[model samples]
Target chain A: MEILLSLFNGILIALEPINLGLAVIGVVVGLFVGAMPGLGSVNGVAILLPFTFVIQSFTGGATSPMIFLAAIYYGAMYGGAISSITLGIPGASTAVATTFDGRPLAMKGMAHVALVAAALASFIGGTVSNVLFTAFAPLLASVALSFGNPEIFALMLLAFATFVGLGGDDIPKTLFSICFGLVLATVGFDIISGEPRLIFFDITGFSHGIRFLVLAIGVYGIGEMIWTINTSRYGSSMSKVDVSWASMIDAMKRFQEAWRGTLIGSLLGFFVGILPAAGATPGSLMSYGVTKMLSKNPKEYGKGAIDGVAAPEAANNSASTGAMLPMMTLGIPGSPTTAVLLAGMVIWGLQPGPLLFTNQPDFVWPLIGSFYVSNLVAVLVNLAFIPVFLWMLRMPFTILAPLIFVLSLVGTYAAYMDMFDVWLMVFVGVGAFFLRILDYPVAPAVLAIVLGPIAEPKLRQSLLLSDGDFSIFFTRPIAGPITVIAIILILLPLFKVIYDKIKGKPAEA
Target chain B: MRRAEIVTAVLLGFFSVYLMWKSGEPPAWDPDVPRFANIGMIDGEGPGSGFWPFWLSAIMLVSCVWIGINWYRKKSPPSVSEEPFLDSYGKRTLFFVGMGLLGFLILIHIIGFYGGILVFMIYYMRFLGRHGWGITSLVSVSLVVFSFFFFDIAMRIVLPKGYLEPLFIPLYDMFL
Candidate 1:
């Protein structure tokens, strides 16, 4: 098939020593970022985008852009495990359940095992997903070409409903939070009108733009710092973080046991990644859940189970790959990182849509192929850094706090030259702090924000195209089935909750 | 969770009512304005382009209220009123957040965005993390300097330089 040949060509381009080097660097950085508590994937990638701008300017090639974008994502994957194993915190929502088992293992002096499993699982997921993307992306893109605006709108709605309903806490609050994000998105420019909607009386940076980085860093980074300072039991902090070759050997043994978990994770992640709203969080959560349900030693789950580590890590990586499906095919971003990638594409004068495959196979294939190289690089770097990363946690907070604080600020400022970013960070932090008190899940809020504005336009476009026929949603077979699926997703949680209550069982995690 | 839900419900209700006012009041007679052609005329005529978002938001608002009412009537124990607000964990988080906010407010004016961020990171890393001076300094300098060159100079984007303008110019020349 020409598609297959093109894909092979992409591999050739992606495997270029320079591109390969960048891919490796991305995975290495992704691991470090993923390991850090609070930095997580989204903020980690966002913080790194400034560097990408520089890369793009100097090289003026698609390779540099792909390297920057892919690296941030890979770094985020690496970052996710750090907090999970060491601090009992899943750096991102997707990895939340990882802490249940990972932290316990670390406490039991198996941090190295947890780290190794995470890395291996992530590597497997990333590599497998890249293969899947290469094999299936074109076929999927062809199918996507026929999708009308109504289908797109329905998909967005499905994503919104599923996230709002299934995300950790109270649905109403989540919707409200999402609405808040939509409001923020609408602040500067009116997409169709090209007129300012909410830009108030002239401020210095107001005319140029309001970068989302400012908001994300302010909320998650600075706000998180404040929240951490307020809540941390430094008195209750980990007593020890020891790394050993023996522990790593044990981790390898655990990985051997969790081969099924890695496979399941990668498969589920791939499927979820292909879907519009199913991102790393759901991918990780679902993989972890399925692994637990199917495990022979179910009791070991949530109690330092090695498979627990593998499932979520794999799920996260695979789902990240999955998130790219829509971006590549439909020009719709399912996740924030992908949204940033979309932004990068726009900046490069390349629009992401059905035409991407035909118009710029040169650009597209290499990026997809590079994912494989990136995943391999991630594994190598993560393995090397295992002991080093583990040991770094033992360093006293006196030295760690200031450095992270500075990195947070510098990272924020680097995204854009505005001090407004710092302020935005504080605002988000304050809001996040309060929401934490209320058990309001930030992920849904974020998901809502990211997807809301996008869906709104699609809905309108669909309506316009259909001459206001709402039936198009149900009439078009592809759109109709997807809508039905969305409906099921919305109702599934309600039914599960009600059934649990009737059965005298507590809510499912 | 219940009381918070109640408040959210009320707010949604209010927002919906507000949207009703906002949606119908878009400046009229613009040729560019789009409208839905058919919808059985919810009121007077078929809904306009803004109709779906506004009405859907309104429906959401109503649903939130219903959810709030159900929780209030059910007397859910997990409600905000039942739980201690700002638990110990919450308090600790607030302090660091305060430090960040205070630092930004004060330093951005005095040191400029780049300097303030660099200083903020160094202070946080050293004070809060208790990292070594070497790691702290190296990370702070590299991140700040590299980002400055990348975003400001190379990108031709301007950063806010309160008192650090003089320093930034020399750096800009070297990179750009």
Candidate 2:
């Protein structure tokens, strides 16, 4: 209740005309950033992060850090959806599944409607997630308090298992990629034994560990470009996606019919986001799949289904907020974006554990409050400006492609203030292209990299707590079921193949 | 699928064996180095901390082999054409990798980050795409300006100044 009141106070602070203006500007800029191919939320945020440092240098305070960071966060979220619908190019990963149907809808001359649905779904998801945050955050935080190292370890194991199972077709190859990620994580100084694993290069760059800014930008950002060039694959040309009152009415009706998907997507997103390693992409995929399964017209899916766009967009936004719960309560980052937020917390000299609520009510509550306001703002901004973004589609790729290239370089350079990072992006991008060819999925590698370092220490910590007893994984009630479920999922495909062969039935991947 | 599986199995088997052989050697350690009793059924103090990874790789190796054998020994033959593997990917691969390598080589030299991007984008968007000069020039210039403001001015993050350092000084003064 006190948290709610504090949130209210924060909302009041965020409602200031100045902050509101900043929010509008941030959302607009963020949308453009997201719409551009080769630039994404991480790049958007990272590109913007250094400016905050500059702002601090000029103004010498952390008064508006949350506002700036939140704006970028919300803006990136909004931006990612634009390209997916119109251009069939997903600017960010969370929107990959969105391209499956959103592009089809655009092709059917309903691009405006699809865009509106996605933007509105994003709003509804964000708002509902905030309400849930207001209602259940303290409760969720309290629940996390009971989780010891063993439960945490089990959770990481589940994450690893899910990455292998859900990421792609080849389980063994995915596992191999994951193992490679784990090996990469093992580089730098070991936190437990203080032993360096793979620092063969005695260079300072290898010492502090492989920065995600470097790796993500390299592998996904640069690697993707190289792969695209290698494949010589040309994107389908975009058409003018004009917003009309008729389309707006049509979108509203579709929203009415698929409101259930939005709600379910938000709920699932919130739940998945609450778990560590269960970030927006998985939440989006799960929500998308579940929505399809429950839909009356499942056949319409992957064929311009409005619910398809609504579900994943809503899921991604809701999960974005969901990711905050673990970050706020447990002091553990639930996603890379949240990890950046954690870094911000450190930058501001504010600790992020349970005590964050007590100590920095002024800082925390207002940020939470702004999330509510921002969602409303994002929807309005998107609806009113749909034509503007749609106009971007008409711009020749010749113009847009170079523009994207320049942004990519700038984004890369800004993140680390080093050309080495930019170069790294090229290397990683090229490598990623090859890996894609070999059917080695990059998402699992990323997920594994994100979860690996955290898992090792937690497992070691659990062992020490239980006096080296491995049974602690199963002896605990909360952690055991999750572990069991993960293991079952891993075996499901293999068992199904066997069962089909034995039963003289057809096989399915 | 059979051929791919066979290749994977062979690769995994070879790599796993190599890893175990290489990592199994005892490292020259200081007295302060931590040691744990090996828990494996292998002779002597069993495998060390590195042993688990080796064994896990071995299991992966075995699994790959099993899957490969199962695929190869299956009674049915593949039905459809597998022409995707035979398609021309070489030109694209070389250009893509070459472009990326060039991006690195040119960084911090004549063409800075922004300049390098401009060049890369022109070649990619114009030469590769066969785009008109008007659109390419506009996009290239706009990207550079946007990047400058976005990264340098708004974010206060510095990009590589390089040879363009002189030009950046004035812009930096204006923005900073």
Candidate 3:
């Protein structure tokens, strides 16, 4: 009853004029960003983060800016399907599984059916995850309120361990990326001792530390754009769709056949998304695989199966919302996009952990309430503006690429008002581009940069209490199991190698 | 591709070692504090500031060495692949894109963000994109104007205008 009353109040606050207006605009902007090839929610959020300050200034609160970004996240999930169904290219990685059956449906000249299914499934998926998140977030946050430094550090360790064990990237490269990001966060002055550290060449810019925004924009904005341009091989042709009312109604009727996949995706995606490393992309792909395996006509899985279209679409949307759970409750970001959001929360002068709920109900409830509003806005805008998004997609990558570069450079400068940071960001972008070519995963690094400052202090504090004894982590009941699990996760690759050797299997990567 | 993998690992290894060394430096104010003195627990002060980053960099160095070993064993994807690190088209794209970005940054130092954006857009749209003057100019000019208003005037961010500062004074006088 209490939860329902709070949710109702949150909804009312979310419906206020300014917040509602921001949601609509944010959803529209997000739709276009998500529909564009090589641009994802992360890219949209990172580039536009600086612009949110304007909204923050006017509102005198964090709720409006957060709603804007969250709406973009919701809109991007819906928009990724647009390019997948229409242009035969996944707009974002979260939409990759959509292309498997979405393109096949388009090729069968049922593009309208695929698009509607995707949009509807995404709507259902998001709604399901929102319900789950609301029910679980307060409970989890209350539980996490008891977490001490050792426990928090252990969770951080587990998060990093998941990246190494289950990230599916090269283990060493993943470790290198994580450690490098953590190290970079140590630049500028040390918070504990007030000592200057890692001030490379003693540049004045190093005094304030390398902001997370600079690294995020460089990696997602510039590096990812360069990667896309180099590797882009998408076909130019698009599937034509009838946007008439009759066709949409017919597509809606066909969407009913997708209920099973939607149900599976909504449940599985939420669970998978709650995990530290397994986010929407893997969630969607896993949902697709599971749905296909259980299908009555398994061979039709990637051959215009409506379930195939629905499963991944729903899963991605569901997973996106699910990814917010840990971020808001425990301060552990479940995905790279959520990591950026976590950083934003810190910047907005709010602590992200369990205390957030107790300390800032106004900020928390409205943001949660905005999630539901943003989902509704995203679906409606997506369905109504399909033709517009398609036309926007045809605007050519050359023009879009330059615009992104301009946004990235200008956004970095605007955020920090530092020319040196701007210069350093470009350098980082170029270096990131090189690292990307070698199959280095940049997401871990981005996540690390955000979590590092939080993790490091907790670790030092924990050790300080234990008189420099490492066993403090192992002795505490809450930290003990978590530390053990993290250790196992970190060593899983080694175990796999040993297992393979014992089984006499030939070496395989 | 195979050769690039080991070379990168070695380079990263050295970089990591340098960071570790850099992390151990004493504070400038108290130069007499021994090196690596701050990388461990103080008697009563608890863990020093350098403790975290220095250890993290050591892990990075170890990770780099592990990457080298993986490369030696041909276990990593890049190490076993026979493809060129950057094909001709890849090389050309990187060169053009990289240089274009560097040029944009260089332009910013002299002309400021708005001016830099205009030149970069024109260069990308006209020369690189092969778009005609009409659309390119229209788009570029429109963007610059929008940025100027949004960033400088309305938001009061005051982006540097470089030599173009004088020209913006009239507009600022009119707006303010």
- Model 1 whole-model lDDT (C-alpha atoms): 0.65
Model 1 CA lDDT for position B46: 30
lDDT of each residue in B1-176, candidate 2, tens digit only: 33544565577668656544433333335554333222232233222344344444555566456545545655222212243422466555566547645763476477566677677767766776778898778777776788778656765556665787887788777768
Docking class of 2: acceptable
lDDT of 1 at A433: 63
Model 3 per-residue lDDT at A138: 64
Off by over 4 Å in 3: A1-141, A165-169, A232-375, A382-390, B153-156, B170-176
Encode model 3's per-residue lDDT on B42-157: one tens digit a residue: 87767898898899999999988888888888888899899998899888988888889999888888887788889999999999888999999998999899888866764466
Cα RMSD, each candidate: 7.1, 5.8, 7.8
Better of 2 and 3 by TM-score: 2
lDDT of 1 by residue, A1-509 (tens): 87678778877877777677677767766665565444456765666666777777777786667765786687677667776676544455566656656766765667888888888899999888887777787676555456567777776666555455433435555555655555444444445434333343434444444454454444455554455556554432443555667767766886898887889899887766666544676567667656765677766765588888898889888888878888988897867778888787887788798788788878887887777667777787878888776775565644444444554555555444456765665577677766665555554444454455556567656665667677878888778988887777666667887899999997542
True contacts kept of 2: 0.24
Please rank every candidate by lDDT, starting with the best: 3, 2, 1
Per-residue C-alpha lDDT of model 2 across residues A1-509, encoded as one tens digit per residue: 77667888988977877667667776777777766544556666666676677656654445466676777677777777887776555666677657657866875767877888899888988988899988788787667557777787786676566445433445556666766566555556656545444443455556556644455545544555455444434553444455677867777777776687788789887777777766786677667766765677765876788888988889889988988888877788878888887787788787888787788887787788778877778778878878876776565544444443444445555555665556666566666665565556565566555556667677766666666667889878998897787677667668877999999997643
TM-score for each candidate, following the candidate numbering: 0.69, 0.76, 0.71
| Candidate 2 residue pairs in clash (backbone atoms < 3 Å) | A50-B155, A51-B155, A51-B156, A222-A429, A223-A429, A230-B92
Residue A371 displacement in candidate 3 (angstroms): 6.4
Better structure of 1 and 3 per lDDT? 3
Per residue, candidate 3 scores C-alpha lDDT tens digits across A389-467 of 4453445667767876887777677666888887888788878888977877665676577568778888888888988
Clash counts for the predictions, in order: 53, 6, 0
What stretches of model 1 exceed 4 Å from their correct place?
A1-118, A165-171, A174-188, A193-219, A233-239, A249-371, A398-405, A493-509, B1-60, B63-71, B77-84, B87-100, B117-159, B168-176
